[model samples]
Target chain A: MSMRALTGLKPIPPSEITPREVFLDRRRFLAGATAAAAGLGTAAPALAEEMAMKLPAARNAAFSTTDAPTAKKIITGYNNFYEFGMGKSDPAASASKMSVRPWTIEIGGAVEKPRTIGIEEVMRLPLEERVYRFRCVEAWSMVAPWIGVEFNKLAALVGPTSKAKYVRFTSVVQPSVMSGVRAEVIDFPYVEGLRIDEAMHPLTILAVGLYGETLPNQNGAPVRVIVPWKYGFKSAKSIVRIDFVEDQPRSTWMKLQPSEYGFYSNVNPAVDHPRWSQARERRLPDFFASTPTLPFNGYADQVASLYAGMDLKKFF
Target chain B: MRSARAADGRFAWATSDPVRALKPLVFLLCLAPALLLVHDVLYDPEALGANPAETIEHVTGDRSMQFLLGTLAITPLRRITGWGKLIRFRRMLGLFAFFYGVLHLAAYIAFDHYFDVPAILADIVKRPFVTVGFAALVLMTPLAVTSTAGWIRRLGAQNWSRLHKAVYAIAVLGVLHYWWLVKRDLTWPMIYGAILAVLLGWRVWNETLGRQRRRPARVRARAEPGPAE
Candidate 1:
């Protein structure tokens, strides 16, 4: 079979695929372009990822954001994966040491079908692209095109028992590979949780890829949860365990600062962080300007009913 | 002896009128950080990565704290080096500290709050870090305004020195502001604290020793014939 036939993929347009020679010589092109554009007599090399891979196309139009997707470099280069380190760029620099291959996620607690599923089994499930607006509690936001299966699919496969009310997600905590785990910044094996209903929502996904390519280690490789309506930290990364529990799980941030970060970390602009205002957010790449933050990060229309009568300030 | 005197004369000439000779250099050095930030924003945007505003705010805030610490160190540094000329730069350093403090506040108001006065005021009142930082800036404003020679003369040297002692409090507040703002790592704030400790320690040590020396001289004066008698 031809390459396209074997892969069951359509042929890429010539204009879309950058030639290998041009990709190889991109540094020189970038230098000239940056010099001409800046006219500052200084050459800045473009921040191009060496591991180039083609990303998949968006599969779900309903879940995608109208906002332009954040650049791949910014999305991958800037991260808050404190498992690698504290600095935003530290994850991108140090996460390469992590081993994601042969990963397994253990499903336990109130699940009827408690089993350890391998990476291959998880990937084999139906996958779709979802463009999500990720709002950080730090008052910054980004939009990403993530490709993965819905969290409900995994939850259904495991079959949560009637007693299960909350689903807890635990990230891999290998001190040997992750240097940040060595620091006592927070308890290791970073844990996060979602209400069972929230986990079952169509918007929640077990993301494995972004921008059509397998997730970079910095962006949470292997598999991670993408909780669109909540702050980015609520979506646990590099997940290793899923526990269905009767009680709400004590997430890492909530455990660290109960008053600052609450368990129900839904994106609410009316509620402000103690240190910073949450009413506005500085969108990445547009550093000078800030736009008013939307309630539920602009996902309120779909998820508003989830917290219809609850006081957000009290919960927040 | 003649050659040594000649060499001293040449040294005096080289060091003469530090206000004229070295003030401009100190001014330029103080202005360099702000200029670099402006250049990065205008021409080389990527130098600050995806969030230039945050980077600018952080850099300016850090520079302001560094200058505050630097201003505090001038006296101790002069004592160690015996470079009386160093005294000429103290006012410039203090002014630079105030300048960077203003810039830091401006960045917060402009980029973070977007000139939202009520929001800015609310943040200062609500956040402990912002409260302490705002306190430090408020303390610095008077010091910067009364830094002129005329103001010093008007206040009298004794009152002027007393009023300026608030800088020590400002330094402490600045460090506290930094420590409170950081999420986890305390390395930078700890370093700033250590430096401030040494500077304050030197001042306390000198004051104690000077008092002891003055007491003995007073005793000696009593033993001798009184000049009035």
Candidate 2:
């Protein structure tokens, strides 16, 4: 396919999309991709045996039901910038080196059902997958097919009360496991939080895998939270704990420098970071063409109400 | 000075001093760090792993600032100790610092900006970090020019010393330039800042106490002088 064909996916309206619309759109794309792959002649039948068989349920909807290499390429190549160690390409190499086997997640804090679950148990959540454009505060972005479950189902199991105001996510902190921690470049136990409402949004996900296979460790294997509206950093990686607290929890970036990283790090263009512009972001895949970064990372329809009556520029 | 040179030429037949030749060799020794940096640019995978072009510029810039601070500290350190030989090495270190600084500025111009003059001008005006770094580079220019023996002789000792004190200003700007560039980490920049502070503090103390303690004798000798020059 031509590069122009790849770039033809226009920018989605920031405040007009719905979960139903996104779900339907992804279904259509996956269906068309499967039909295209099937027509690849004898090569498809020949390569089917050589290619590793992926579980149908675990495949990201964007790549699921399709044997197309293009779908797999997009899923792997286009992803959150943080997975690359805060650089654009760091994830592609460093993440590949990471091992994502025999993992368990410790789920504790305000949940009544506080328990340690195996990676397999976490993967078995009622699945729903969606394609999201993740925008980073560093002015780079990616579109990826995230396969996971509705976060509210996980939260509902936890038994959140009226007292619970936020859900703080913590990634695994062992320096050996996450090499980025060893440098002391950033304070560790990487944290991100969502106000109780945002945590319970249907679009918010707890992803276990992608591209029709178990999540590679570089992509927050086993399980990671995906808050589509917030900047990509808000999607905590390699999760170890989920805390339901009564107040807003402290995040890693905010604890390091509160002024630069506001708690509500929603993707708003008007609020420029002290060091760089927020007005535009370089989209991965189309690395040469930068487009205007949308507010709420173009998830305003699902999340705008969560910040009602609050000024994004001030909060940001 | 001419008679001394004529006498030295006549005596040249009497001896060939290898010590004089070693001075140039020592000058080459002072370039070890810059040469090592170029070596790192070729071998260090991490240096160019992210944005190869931008990372190259940052490494060059960091080495430049470090050498500049090292060169500036030499005078105060030499005077405090009785290490007069430090004098022979000062000019070489100062020139290397300037050479790296030139490379730092050139990379920013060529790779970072691709010689986009308008963007660079805007950055200098709009960004605090760029403004401080650019100002330091500008201040370093004149000091590098008057580094030669000919310019020192032409400018006179008194004027040369005063003009070259601009290195102190550049040191301060360099520290500030690093401090403002960090996102969340302050440890590295703060360490550099603390060292620069102590070095500059030594210079200030030396100017007030070391120079003043000797000034009275000179005053007295001049007062007792019979005729004015």
Candidate 3:
């Protein structure tokens, strides 16, 4: 096959400093410069207060790097449910219309140190960019560069108790602002959850942004989770709340149909849905008829241990 | 007499008792594009370019929805135009939709997953799009099973009609299922969404007009001197 087949038809445009960037940049600037300002300016203490409340920056910062292959998959396959109005890709297009600035993640529930953190305060953590392959159950896959913190590290800031067996995620459901939610055609207030162990997986992430910039609204701006071992939906998007639960929390898919959606939706090639086969997937960047799917989407070594003793068939 | 004679002539052409009649002919003609799509998947898989299986699945899926949407438009079209003859093809078109849906799913199984049952099951649980798409397929099963005259006769018209109304829900699911599967392009989904909106809008309009037509007659009859009430 010719490399000519892959020649660019059009280049991805450069990232712009949207209202979101300016707003976040201001917040980050304030938070980082707070120490100097405490002596020189009145703005310093407020910034310091904001920074102090942020979820622990240590672990989240360590997991922020994005490598090329993983980045490609994450960018394409991890769709923005905000875009198409519902489902995954809804965010990819519809998110572009959103004013993502002035966004704050509300962290409350069973937490000893609950706090609402601004996007800028979250970004102030050291960011690592990692490239991860994203596979959709729809039989297509993409590799993407994702930027965020390891979810375990982010969750640590809240000091999750042993009582918390699950982590529930909530997306904003504003119909007046989110016109897609107004459509009676689709159910709204999309929710997803992960078991505490799954939530704290080293591969699990609380992604802040992607492609070397703040997340595009279509890509789950503000923040989203990336659970590489599970089917893409397990990751959730446009996350607002991260409640630590004593029980396995209900996710949108499982709520829609429990017979099919299991709590542990780990990526396993061993099980097939009653309606369709799943032995192979269409690898994105396929650019043609043949790109073979990898087991565990090429993250088997990293994530396989999470599912050691479980029956994948029953769990699936 | 002349108008009646002309109507008879048109009916004869529309449904002459000969071997290849109008319904079958129109069905075949309407089915050609989808048939060509299926052929490409089976015979010329390479011709599909990037992701042949997905391209085929998409073509089959798009056509299935188009057929289902077309099938749904029949009654509303007849009501609006008073061309009740259009209802003659609803069963055929509906079956064709089922046929295409089955094929669309088959492509997913055969080409995409290579018949890996466990992996497919895991995916359905993991992916919302696949789950919805799978639900749409399951919903189609009974509709296809009951499409035949034998089953329809056995079930009776009222029960059969009620069971078949699931097609409307399926159409909505089918569109959503398709929309969810798409990566970036909005053009195709926007087209289908607009078309489905109009198709569904026509149904609502027809129902409202039907209710309005029945209301005055009911009131007037009650007002008239009659034992009917």
Instruction: Name the candidate that leads on DockQ.
Output: 1
Winner by lDDT between candidate 2 and candidate 1: 1
Candidate 1 local lDDT, residue A124:
59
DockQ of each: 0.47, 0.08, 0.10
Clashing residue pairs in candidate 1 (N, C-alpha, C atoms within 3 angstroms): A55-A212, A56-A212
**lDDT of all predictions:** 0.85, 0.68, 0.67
Highest lDDT against the true fold, candidate: 1
RMSD (Cα, Å) of candidate 2? 14.6
Model 2: CA > 4 A from native: A1-116, A126-135, A139-150, A156-165, A173-190, A201-203, A209-222, A280-294, A298-309, B1-47, B76-92, B95-99, B102-127, B208-229
- Model 1 chain B TM at 0.84
lDDT of 2 by residue, A1-316 (tens): 8666899976666444443323433554465457568885434322322322243454345422222222355445344434235444455546643444445777677777778766655655677656677677766666666678888987776687677788899887655634456666677778889888888988788886566555655567658888777887898988878888988998988987888898889998778787665766655433222467787877777678889999887888
In model 1, which regions exceed 4 Å deviation?
A1-57, B1-22, B209-229
Measured by TM-score, the strongest candidate is 1
